[model samples]
Structures are given as C-alpha cells and as structure tokens.
Target: MQKKIVKMFDEIAPSYDIVNRIVSFGSDKLWRKIAIKKSLKHLPKNPKILDVACGSGDMIEEWKKYTDNIIGLDPSQKMLEVARKRFPEIKFYQGLAQNLPFDDKSFDVISISFGIRNVVEIQKAIEEFARVLKKEGILLILEFTKPEKKSTIRNCIDFYSNKILPKIGGIISGNKEAYEYLPNSIQKFYTLNELCEKLNKKFEVIEAKNFKLSPASMIIAKKI
Candidate 1:
C-alpha cells in the first residue's frame, strides 16, 4: 500500500500543488500557516525541524520562515525533486515515516501535513516521531479525518470531496484515480479524537482544531 501510494504521488507530482490550490480554493496554505503558527508557540527560536512525508516540501517552506535547520523526508523521488528545485539549500531524504534514518532525539520539531494517513504502519510512525524528537519537542500534524457524525454541512462536504473533487482534481492533475483515493483514504482514516488518543500515548496533545466545512484538521503535540 505504501509503495503504491508513493508511486501515485510521484505520478501526480507535477500537478499536485496546482490541483490542491484548485480543489481547496487555496485554503491549504491558510491551514499550513495556522498549523505552523500554533507550533511556534511551543517551540524555541530556530528549532531543528523534520518534515516527514513532506510532499513537495510545502510544510518545510513554511518552516523556513523561522529556521533553516530543517530536513525533509518523503518516499516520492519526483516530489522531492520538485522540492529540491524550490529549496536547494535544504537537505531531503527519500525515506518512509515508519522508519526514519536519523539518530534518536535528533530534532526539536517534527511535522507531517496531510500525509499521516498514508503511512501503513501509523503507530510505528508515531513511535518513530517520538523516538526522533527531543524531550518536550513539538509534533505538528495536519490531516484529513473521517467525520464523527452526519449533518447537512457534512453531507455537502462529502459530496464535494467524494464526487466533485475527483473530477476537478483529475482533470487538472491528469490522475483521476489518485484524486479518488484521497476521499476513500479519508473515509478509512482515524477521526480527530482517535488520532489524538494515539498521539497521547507518546505525547501530550495540546490542541486539535477542525476547519470549518472541511474534513481536514490540525494537531499540535509535545513529546512527553
């Protein structure tokens, strides 16, 4: 599953950012800004950061506003190629979230935006996050979660994500199947509460915020 997802991302690498802007109406940037802002509150100035599953280095781009001591890890070479071209100074590694190629307590902050659900061994990945982060370090996650309940607004969101998003995203990205997997993955992913519970096992979950009219959510945690 992980290998297939990596290949899918690689195939969509060229149009990933463009399709995201169109589908999310550019709100993805706002969400990343919000997550980064919240993370800074608990982190020191110029903290060393690691962005896992850092597709196209979007979160790392946000992190660069504060510090340059950042590393990005992703499984898709094509995506990293785009990221490298965008930020030539930063080092990027091709690695899986479940197995990071780094020493223990190596980073002060670790972030994964919209990529946690892609990990097949999610708990192992969470453990790897804890292992690589220093004590009291920050963990920032921006993810799409399954809805807790049904509502009129949620139903509308479901329609857009499951039906409309694939068509528009497929048209723009030229990979309808990849866009289709987005909604299906969200449906099978953990809810906000469930994800926080998992984080709580290794970190103190400080905040979990849900965006209006969207399935995406952000989590800020501190390693315990």
Candidate 2:
C-alpha cells in the first residue's frame, strides 16, 4: 500500500500544485498560511521545523519566512526532487512518516498538511511525530475532514468534496484515481474529535478549527 501510494504521488508530482489550486480554488494556500501562523505562535525567535509529507516543500518555503532551519521529508523521491529544485538550499529527505530518520527532539515544530491521511500506518506516524519533537514542540496538522451530517452547508461541501472536486482534480492532474482517492481517504479517516483523542496521548491539543463547513480542519498541539 505504501509503495502504491509513493508511486501514485510520483506520477502526480508534476501536476500536484496546480491541481491543488484548481480543486481548492486557491483556499489551500490560505489554509496552509493559517496553519503556519498557529504553529509559530509564541515560539522562540529561531525554531527548527520539520515538514513531514511535505509535497514539493511548500511548508519549507513558508517556514523559511520565520527561520532557515527547516527540512522536508516525504516518501516520494519525485516529489522531493521538485522540492529540491525549488529550494536548493533547503534540505529534503525521502522517508516515511511512520519511521522518520531524525534524532529525538530534533525539531521545535513539526507540520504535515493535507497528507496525513495517505499514511498507511497513521498511528505509528503520530508516535514518530511525538518522538522526534522537542518537549513542548508544536505539531500542526492541516487536513481534509469528512463533513458533519445534515446541515445544508455541510451538504454543499460534501457535494463539492465527493463530486465536484475529484472531477476537476482528475481532469487537471490526468491521474483521476489519485484525486478520486483523496475524498474517500478523508471520509474513511478519523474525525476531528477522534484525532484529538489519539493526539492527546502524546501531545496536548491547544487549538483546533474547522474550515469550509467542516470539510477541512487545522490542529495545533504541543508535545506533552
């Protein structure tokens, strides 16, 4: 499953960014910017950042605004290649989230945006995030979430997520399965409350918000 996911990402590497803009209507950038702000709030002047599943190193670029000690890690070598090309000075590594190749307490801030659900062993990945993060380290997650049942607003978002999004994304990226799998993954993944429960085992959930009628979410936690 992991290999298949890596291959899927590798195939979509070239079109990932553009397809994301199309699917999210550019709101993805705002989501990420908000995540960065929440993660960096009250942090020290200089904080080390690690962006796991950092496709093409978008987080690396954003983190660089505050500090230069930033690294990107992902399982797809092709994605990492794009990241390397974009920011030659920023270091990037090809690795799985479940088994990060980093020392304990290596980063003061760790973030994974819109990619956590793709992880096969999601629990292990969270554990690894806790292991490598410094005590009181920030853990920020920006991800798609399944919408709540029955509200008109949520119904519209659900229609967009399960229907309109995949259609547009598939056409743009030319890897329809990749886009189709995205909405399904979010539906099958944990709810915000359930996710916070798992996170609370190793970290304290400090801030949480729902975006786009609960179809997306942001979570900022600190290592316990």
Candidate 3:
C-alpha cells in the first residue's frame, strides 16, 4: 500500500502543484506562506532544516528565503526529480520518513506539510524526527484534519472537500484514485487534539492553529 502511494504520487508529479492550486482555490499557496512565517519565529539562524516527504520541494524553496541550510527528502523519485530541477543546488534524498537517512541530532528544524498522513508508520516517523533533531530543535507539521460535525459551514466545507475536490483534482491530474484518496485520507486522519496528543509524546507543543473553513492544521513543537 505504501509503495502504491509512492507510485500514485510519481504518476501525478507533473500536475501535482497546479492541481493543488486549482483544487484548493489557491488557498494552499497562501497557507504555506503563513505556515512558513509562523514556523520561522521558533527557528534559529542557519538551522539545518529537513523537509520530509517534501513533494516537488516548494516548501523547501520557501524555507530557503530564510536560510540556505535546507535539504528535502521524498519517497518518490519523480517527485524528487521535479524538486531537484526546481532547486538544482539543494540536495534531496529519496527515502522514507519512518527511516530517515540522517544521523542523530543532525538538524535544528524538521517539517512535513500535507504529506505525513501517507506515512506507513507514523509513530516511527515521529520518533525518527525526534532522533535526528537536535535537543530542543523545532518540528513543524502542517496537515489536513477531519472537520468538526456541528456547523453548517463546516458541512459545506466537507461537501466540497469530499465531493467536489476529487472530481476536479482527478480530472486535472489524470488520476482519479489519487485525488479521491486524499479526501478519504483526510477523513480518516487524526483530529487536532488527537494528533497533538501523539506529537506531545515526542515533543513539547509550542502552538497549534487551523485554517478557516478547511481541515488545514499546523503544529509547532520542540524536542523535549
């Protein structure tokens, strides 16, 4: 199943970025900008940052605006190929999050955006993040959350997310299952508190926030 996930991403690599922009109505771009600014407050100068599951490397590029000491890791070679083309000078490793290729205490900051949900062994990945990070190093996560059930607006967001998004994304990406899997994944994913609770096992939560009318979640934590 994990290898299938990687294959799906590889098949969609050409349209990944643009389909995201279209499907999210361009909100994803704005969300990343906000996430970067918010996460920056806790980062140190020249922090060795690693973006795990760094699809197409856009997030790494955004981080570069702050510091050049950044590298990206993704399981899909085609995705990494696009990323490498985008930032030729930056190093990218093809690897899994549960088994990172870095040494202990090697980085000051680590990030994974919208990609952690697909990880096969999420807890192991989080532990690896902790092991590779310097003591008190920052771990930033931006992921899709399952929405609450009580509001009319939230219901509408759910409809768009589960119904409309897959249709449009599938058409654009030429891979229906890939986009369909997204909504299903989001639905099955942890809630804000649930994920934060898991994260707290490895690190101290610094802050947690949500994007309006969407399941977008961000957590900034530090190694304990």
Candidate 4:
C-alpha cells in the first residue's frame, strides 16, 4: 500500500502543489508559516533543519525564510525531482520518514506537514524523528484534525472532504485514486490529543494549536 501510494504521488508530482493550493484555498501556506514559527522557538542561532515526507518542497521553501541549512527528504523520487528542480540550492534526498537516512542527533529542528499519517509505521516514524533530532531539538508536525464543535460547519467540512475534495482533486491532478486516498488517509488519521500522547512518549509536548476551526492543527514537541 505504501509503495502504491508513493507511485501515485510520483505520477501526480507535476500538479500536486497546484491542486493543494487550490483545494486548501491558499491556507496551507499559512499553516506552514505557523508551524515554522512554532518550531523556531527551540532552534539555535543557526539551526540545521530536516523536513521529512516533504512532498514537493512547499514546506521546505517556507522554512528557508528562517534558515538556509535545511534538507528535504521524501520517499517519492519523482516528487524529489520536482522539488530539486524548483529549489536547486536546497538539499533534497529520496528517503522515508519511517527509516530516515541520517545520523543520530544530526538536526536541530525537524518539520513535517500533512505527511506523517501516510507513513505505514507511525510509531517507527516518530522514533526516527526523535533519533535524528538533537537533544532539545524541536519536532513540528502540521496535520489534519477532526473538528471538536460538531456544528453545521463541521458537517460541511466532512461533506467536502468526503465528497468534494476527491472529485476536485482528481479532476485537477488527473489521478482519481490518488486524490481519493488523500481524503481517506485524512479521515483515518489520529486526532490532536492522540498524536500528542504518541509524541509525549519520546518528546515533551510544548504546544498544540488548531487552525481553520480545528480542521487542521500543528503540534510542537521538544526532544528531552
């Protein structure tokens, strides 16, 4: 399943960012900015940052505003190819979050946006994030969340995610199954508290803030 999903992303690499910006109505960029600011709190004067599962380097580009010593890692080579072409100066590697190809305590900050839930072994990925991070390093994760209000707006979001996102994403990306997997994965992902608990096993949870009325949240955890 993981391999299939990676290949699907490889096929959609060309239009993935375009579809993402359109589907999220440009709020994805704001989410990345907030996540970066939260992660920057623990960073050193000149921090070394790693972005895992970094689709086409959108988040990495956002991180560049704070620091230049950054590496972007993704499992899909095609996605990396696009990212490499777009940001020729930034380092990018073909890698996975579950098994990061880095030495222990190698980075000061690690960030991943909307990608952790796609990993096959979520625990292993979390462990990998902890392993590569330096002592007191910050690990930031921006992910989709289930709404707490359960109001009409929540119902509307559910309807759009389950019904409309896939249709529009498919038409734009020309990959129906890939777009379908997006909503399915988001629906099957863990909630904010659950994710915080999982991170607490390895790091200290500094903050967890929900955005867009709880449809998205960013969790910042510091390695102890």
> For candidate 1, what is the total of clashing residue pairs?
0
Residue 26, model 3: Cα distance from true site in angstroms: 1.6
Our model 1 lands, by Cα RMSD against the true structure, at 0.7
lDDT value for model 2: 0.86
Let me know the TM-score candidate 2 reaches against the reference structure: 0.96
Q: Tens digit of lDDT per residue, candidate 2, span 59-81?
A: 77788888889989999988998
- Indicate the TM-score of model 1: 0.98
Regions of model 2 farther than 4 Å from truth: none
Clash pairs for candidate 4: none
* Clashing residue pairs found in predicted model 2: none
**Candidate 1 local lDDT, 1-224, one digit each (tens):** 78999999999999998898889999999999999998999998889999999999889888888889999999999999999999999999999999999999999999999999999999999999999999999999999998888889999999999999999989988899999999999999999999999888899999998899899999999999
Question: Candidate 3: minimum summed lDDT over ten consecutive residues — where?
Answer: 146-155
Better of 2 and 3 by TM-score: 3
Better of 2 and 3 by lDDT: 3
Question: In candidate 3, what are the lDDT values of residues 26-116, reduced to their tens digit?
Answer: 8877788888888778878778999999999878878988888998999999999999999999999999999999999999999999999
Q: Rate the local accuracy (lDDT) of all candidates.
A: 0.94, 0.86, 0.90, 0.86
Model 1 C-alpha lDDT versus the unseen true structure = 0.94
- Could you tell which candidate, 3 or 4, scores higher by lDDT? 3
Candidate 4 ranges beyond 4 A from true positions: none
Candidate 2 at residue 12, lDDT? Answer: 92
